[model samples]
Target: MTLLHMSINAHDPQRVSEFLARILGGEALPFPPFPDCWIAFAGSDDGTAIEVYPLTHQLVAGVDQVECRVGGERAEPTFAHIALATPMPADEVITRAGDEGWPARTCNRGPFQCVEIWIEDRLLIEVLDPKMRADYRAGMTVRNWRAMFGMNTQ
Candidate 1:
């Protein structure tokens, strides 16, 4: 029932892959089966992974919007942003993100707090606090999860 991996469309897969590896402490490995993709495997040794794919690659079919219709409006998913539980402090993550030129902001959604970093100024990544990730893994509805950790300010 645990998440195994998540694939994201990246304008530059190789660069994004390296960026994720540096921030998330993962190995960016190329998939032999997919010539144009790489995977940034982070989290626990047996946890989840972040799959990086070229945005324009044939695989993605040019559909870049990762959105869903809600109340007749387009909106992002609750867990839309990739959440990474890090051993490093939240401040450290922000510092590194800044050094790498990624726009980052500290956010608190209800009981959960994280530093949301926009990779390449487009992709969303939430550097989570290790202390609170357990409660995050406890499984709440997407609405609750969004209300607690999503980026929707409205």
Candidate 2:
């Protein structure tokens, strides 16, 4: 099974986390460096964690800004990021996301023309395509197909 959480570095960790939380309906989280708050959602403890921290990097491609600043080395986030799914319908999720200042756009990537996310140089998320889910289920149960190349169930 795929792991559950992904982390990212944030110039304003609280703001970035809250930005994600609003769309995902996550709980407010306490930020590090004291007296600040971040945001996160609750899920089964699938053994994963996300850590957001501050850095300094000038806006390139002009999508980011210094909403707040913590002076130090201008460390650009060159590591992991996260993708969050909405329980709400995709259209509603898109609309609500725009309303909450997450500029979202959709594209297709991966097998069978899957729907994917390009959330502003953040995480690349594939919105669960119903067809893909069904296909996955079918593939798992089809033993003749599954056993072809040493995938035989014990």
Candidate 3:
């Protein structure tokens, strides 16, 4: 299965959405379902997207489904992160993130390399450019993962 979208909280949803859209070579638009929320569409065939919500927002179970609500709090340096594929160059990604006043650096993940961009100095988003995405796709295999973790391939 493939992941089409994921949600993240940002101190500035509009700015974050715009940054993400530039990275994905797409567009940022207001999320119709949720007020004050923005969505960054990757414009890819698979419909990859990222939903940006306010930092204080949270998703809770409603009567019939999940709903976004206020009153949630977050600590800096959350463990949750996403590795996104991008068509932009690695240097451009780093530069753009730096322009946003966010800390970004190239990270070597043994099998592949990605740029780690810290949003609002809190959330982490690993960005992989074309070359890096190719490396990721080549290295991130079930067999390779099992071998690295000393798990049985069978």
Candidate 4:
């Protein structure tokens, strides 16, 4: 099956959900099975979803960890890596994110344009391919930069 949304556990999901909802087109979702809260955005009727899991309460005290996604891959994002849309212009995304207290960066990654963010922690997000992003915004396909970091591009 296709990859689903990324999950993050937070203490104030309501606030976080509201933020994501406005910035990333996500909507708060029900979270009963887990002890934490959740928010999600399924880009379209037929596509992948991005899930946010806020840890209302930790499984054990002193355990504070949030998931991570780098270059379209999921892992324990030591940084608050967020996925963003394209065609929004890298400059605009960075400015907006910074204004919201979430720092963002941009670069032309080969054929894929990218924007990385750092909010609360070191977040890495991207706004890619102008053409595809417009299409994805229209529900044609996914609209985030396929983040790539390396000696060649970071």
Q: Name the candidate that leads on TM-score.
A: 3
Give per-model TM-scores. 0.41, 0.31, 0.53, 0.32
TM-score computed on alpha carbons, candidate 4? 0.32
**Model 1 per-residue lDDT tens digits across residues 103-146:** 77776534456677777766667677666465454432233334
Candidates 2 and 4 compared by TM-score, better number: 4
Give Cα distance to truth, residue 47, candidate 3, Å: 17
Worst 10 residues of 1 by lDDT: 59-68
User: For residues 1-154, could you state the per-residue lDDT of candidate 3 as single tens digits?
Assistant: 2343567888899999999988988777776556788878774523466779887775543343334566546644442457788889999999999999987888776678888787786666778888887777666544554465565555
Native-referenced Cα lDDT, model 2: 0.42
What value does the lDDT take at residue 59 in candidate 2? 21
Candidate 4: segments with Cα more than 4 A from true spot? 1-82, 129-154
The model with the greater TM-score, 1 or 3, is 3
Deviation of model 4 at 111, angstroms: 3.3
TM-score of candidate 2 against the unseen true structure = 0.31
Query: Which sections of candidate 3 miss by over 4 Å?
Result: 1-74
Give one digit per residue, the lDDT tens place, for model 2 in 109-132: 222222234355443443433454
> What is the Å distance of residue 58 in model 3 from its true position?
18
